[model samples]
Target: MAERKPIESWLTDMDGVLIHEGTPIPGADAFIKRLRESGKPFLVLTNNSIYTPRDLQARLSRMGLDVPVDNIWTSALATAKFLDDQRPGGTAYVIGEAGLTTALHDIGYVLTDHEPDYVVLGETRTYSFEAMTKAVRLINGGARFICTNPDETGPSTEGPLPATGAVAALITKATGKKPYFAGKPNPLMMRTGLNAIGAHSETSAMIGDRMDTDVLAGLEAGMQTFLVLTGLTTVEDTEQFPYRPTRTVDSIADLVDLV
Candidate 1:
């Protein structure tokens, strides 16, 4: 009935949409390549806060995708930005690996467990009960609570493992303070990604695999959303959600021609 708006830029979820279990999905690399060649601004959005952009780039390079480090946006980075904007040069008691720590450090945040301004939770391979206990006490003692993502579990070679959200829940139960999540499903993360790429929401498309995180975040950010049935979601799964994606495809392969 009307002319379709051209997508001038894009934001894509990394784990499910582009790769799965440490492997690139078929046609994902080509899709990224096409975006690169076309000079369209795009960003790879990830909720995984375990790795830095350089580490992610190396991993993607091994999978034959040549995404530059700057093209990758992570929840850790968004969390750091949020902290910096809220409290410049603030102190934090962080529970994560190099990715989260590095981002905070880059923004001039001091990491401390001694009466810190915030208790920032992030994804990690090892979830120590001792550290979690410390976090609970700190929040009880009046530190603000923040989290990188709300994913209750993360996929691994073995199986799904408890993630930041699960741990945050434990802390919340102990202290009765819910964390402010900084990852997908939060429109702030999507807006931060768009700001990083200098892209407009109206002409941008967000490609994701999950209806809850990717689609919701994209829609909240005022961008068109596309769901790819490559990982967690299926055609039937969409019905479970109250909202629907602007488009759905079997895989990224099906959308290559549109590039």
Candidate 2:
């Protein structure tokens, strides 16, 4: 086997690795501080498309994680980038919040419901049947379909909430069309993120909490993967997956030295 290159840059999931349920994880602040002090390129990644980078930065700041706006990346941004690359300045019928809409708008995509070029779906706290019905109808009218991520559920104080992927499934069942997912588990998300930071996969490492999305995406993108147990995945759960992360640690604190 070929030897691996030293990790120079970093990519990490936001929710599980840094903050959980609106609280900062122990050692997370120090980890971010170390990364900043090192001057190594790093990005905070999230599949949640409900908030823009600015909004997220504020939220994280409240939790004591001082991540800069430019260091954040989201599924909404990735989806927008994909659309911009495929069809510049295209029209779309969007079903999402400011994060998704703002991203598309920033890329010169007009949001409309009449004969749009694509039906874009993204995460939102309030998933209205009316908006979903419009999406299904527009897709039936020959509009292409695009989704930010494929996460079926999202975390909440009460419990799991239906997210973009669940709504996307409903629209797919109605129109018999599968929207292209542009988030983690699709190497596009990881590759685009790496490119955004001017980091190469060969010298970068990804820190995540889920084996399904984060680890898989990092591995596919040719980066070393670290599975932190501070979120969804348990140590026992790691055994169930066919592929393994490059390393597994207890939490973000464990990786502070690596930065």
Q: Which is the leading candidate under lDDT?
A: 2
How badly does each model clash, as a count of residue pairs? 0, 0
Query: lDDT per model, in order?
Result: 0.93, 0.94
Give residue 205's error in model 2 in angstroms. 0.7
lDDT of 1 at 33: 89
User: How close to the true structure is residue 60 of candidate 1, measured as C-alpha lDDT?
Assistant: 95
Task: Output the number of the TM-score-best candidate.
Answer: 2
Candidate 2: global Cα-lDDT?
0.94
Measured over all alpha carbons after superposition, the RMSD of each candidate to the real structure, in angstroms, is 1.1, 0.7
lDDT of 1 by residue, 125-231 (tens): 98899999999999999899999999998899999999989999999999999999999999999888899989989889999999989999999998899999998
User: lDDT, candidate 1, residue 230?
Assistant: 93
- The list of candidate 1 runs beyond 4 A from truth reads 1-4
TM-score per prediction, in order, is 0.98, 0.99
